[model samples]
Target: MSRAVLWTKVVAGGLLMVVGGPAFVEYIRPSDEELRKRYNPDLQKRSAEQGERRAQEFDDYVNKLKHWSKSDKSIWYAAQEELDNKRAAIEAQRAQAKEETRTQREEMRKEMLGEK
Candidate 1:
């Protein structure tokens, strides 16, 4: 290419980068809260729903176990144990969420009071 054309191309490329870099970063970059919200907008609601469904399943299994023959007792107990583990995990998740919300509220309160 001619010198003038090459210089013009370089200038245009620089201009595009200068203008587009921030826009590109802004378009792709997400704040921590935004990322969390995008990934789990209704954490409490979803967790509660999942816990409810699992509890219902546990109840159904218990009822089935109650009427099942003695030979099947071990199988039913194993299933119940699995459900118990799931319930424990769900409870832990709920506790973690509660802790996070509590910390967030405390931070907001401190911000309002002009304290770090």
Candidate 2:
């Protein structure tokens, strides 16, 4: 085949696929209204129940977040500050224990050498 004819055929085939692919899928798949009309009652009930449960869970989550935000500041920033405060407290305690141990060790060494 000539180069022009070959190129034309390739371009035409590509366009046909880009347009026809979605059309073919649309023709095969059922629309939402048709699917609803053919829906089973038991399945529909379960789906609705699941949706309600998810909505309730989301409400509970939001309420819990509101309860946690006692201050008028940004909730996320407040939470982060609380986390940082806890970490600082823990580090302070660790440092205090280390200092106490060092003092005790010095006392023991002085007593062993009778240095008083």
lDDT by residue (tens digit), candidate 1, 1-116? 79999999999999899999989998899886665566554885686579789999999877766655344458667667768999999999999999999999999999989963
TM-score of 2: 0.42
- Per-model RMSD to reference: 25.7, 13.3
Evaluated against the true structure, the overall lDDT of model 1 is 0.82
**lDDT of all the models against the reference?**
0.82, 0.87
Q: Best candidate per TM-score, number?
A: 2
Candidate no. 1 TM-score: 0.37
